[model samples]
Target: MMKTTKRSDRIDLRIDPKAKETIQAAALLRHKTISEFILENAMGAANEILAERRHFHLDAKQWEAFQAALDAPPRPLPRLERLMQEPGMFDGPEQEA
Candidate 1:
């Protein structure tokens, strides 16, 4: 089923006079209203930021190596084991309340 979403919010901002002129000229050049141009560009930028990690394109050879790494068995790290064994501040003797 398709979902219908409403854009019922407003975002108002004040830009420098020169900045506003620049954006307005760009929008006119693109044959779009200021709102449309701003929304399209902003949405494109937002998607790039948010979806950066959500999509990955890998060739077959890279995919094979990635799969092999994930398939490898767990291995213990000696340094990590030694660190865990060492005493920490939390390991101090507890005092009665």
Candidate 2:
């Protein structure tokens, strides 16, 4: 599939002049525009943050257990079902303090 690199938004940041100069130097060293350098590095860090948030690295035994849990049929818990049927914290009452 063809991809587009059309930037249709803006993000303005205020930073120390020293930080800006440092970024400028880094960008020059990498032979990339300031925007490209920032986006590439920032996106790399962003991807790490998101991957850490969303993906798990399970060992073989843990993976087996995880798969088993997913494949198992639902178990009934009468207490839990009843608890859910009860009025929720915000519903139908003003509890005394």
Candidate 3:
């Protein structure tokens, strides 16, 4: 069944005239609606900020295993063929519900 929920919610913002002008000019240059441009720019900035503050610590043996997996050649899963043949698993023009 398809989801009946809506993911978007509306927001109201107040900004200095000069800041708004700069944002509008950048959005126009990018050929996006003001909201789209703002959301994309904000998301990129957020991801960068989060990346700088994020850290991961792993024990020596776990770290070695992680590195080994990364170095290994990719392997095909045996179940993939059966899964692909199953009906109505993918939602696309080629697949009928």
Candidate 4:
């Protein structure tokens, strides 16, 4: 099977002259093009925004519980061995003749 790659659509955004100059200076200092600098910063901002949206926001007690779980000792159950060897529940029911 073949897969198709996605391409970016052209976008135009306006910024102040000072901001553009600052970006150009930074890009030059880093030996990157303005587009590369903008895309890098945009991707970082997108990741932060997306992570914020997808993560759970915990309160003090919940945070303590989460931390406690992380610090707690691991326990093993005998049933886990049986479960690990068995076919998954998702395998579905038997087929009829």
Candidate 5:
């Protein structure tokens, strides 16, 4: 059984007629009300967006490997060093007075 939570919040949106129709069609296909469909998808998207910045879990071996990688020194990149040394396009020749 699913637990129900009390809802006391309201959100209003103004969408184009075509968008509304599309949403309504999708909701009907899923057998959900428009509000339920929108809220479900919206929350799913929100969770995905926030997930990357929020938290992650790793097993013991994975955690050890991760720590090892973090502790390892960075490798030198000669090409990247040369690229950095080269004057950028924005670093144009000084204008003559």
Candidate 6:
């Protein structure tokens, strides 16, 4: 069973007439209102985009390589260490307003 939630938020779009017509035709083909079609497709696209950030899959060989890299000893970065030891621009005494 699917649970329904009250939709209290609204989104407005200013689309070109041709775009609107195309969307309307597609929505009709799917037997959904324009709002339903747009929301469903947009949500699907949003999930795909966010999934890249939230989850990753690796094959056995790739997983082994990744684990090896993580297990490797830390490398020395003299320049980076020197840069970190130096005072940054914001580290100086604050100037009066």
In lDDT terms, which candidate is top?
A: 6
Candidate 6: C-alpha lDDT: 0.98
Q: Which lDDT values do the candidates have, in the order given?
A: 0.92, 0.94, 0.87, 0.90, 0.97, 0.98
Better of 2 and 6 by TM-score: 6
Rank by lDDT, highest first.
Answer: 6, 5, 2, 1, 4, 3
- Per-residue lDDT value at 58 in model 6: 99
Residues 20-60, candidate 6: write the lDDT tens digits.
99999999999999999999999999999999999999999
Compose the digit string of candidate 1's lDDT tens values, residues 48-70: 98898798988999999999999
**Which candidate wins on TM-score?**
6
8-52, model 5: which lDDT tens digit per residue?
999999999999999999999999999999999999999998997
Worst 10 residues of 4 by lDDT: 4-13
1-97: candidate 2 lDDT, tens digit per residue: 9897879998888999999999999999999999999989999999999999899899999999999999999999999999998989779786798
RMSD vs true structure, all candidates: 4.9, 6.1, 14.8, 11.0, 8.8, 4.8
Residue 93 accuracy (lDDT) in model 6 = 75
**TM-score of predicted structure 4:** 0.51
TM-score of each: 0.59, 0.67, 0.46, 0.51, 0.58, 0.69
Please give the ranking of all candidate structures by TM-score, highest first, separated by commas: 6, 2, 1, 5, 4, 3
TM-score of model number 1? 0.59
Query: Which residue segments of model 6 deviate by more than 4 Å?
Result: 1-12, 92-97
Which of the two candidates, 4 or 6, achieves a greater lDDT against the reference? Answer: 6
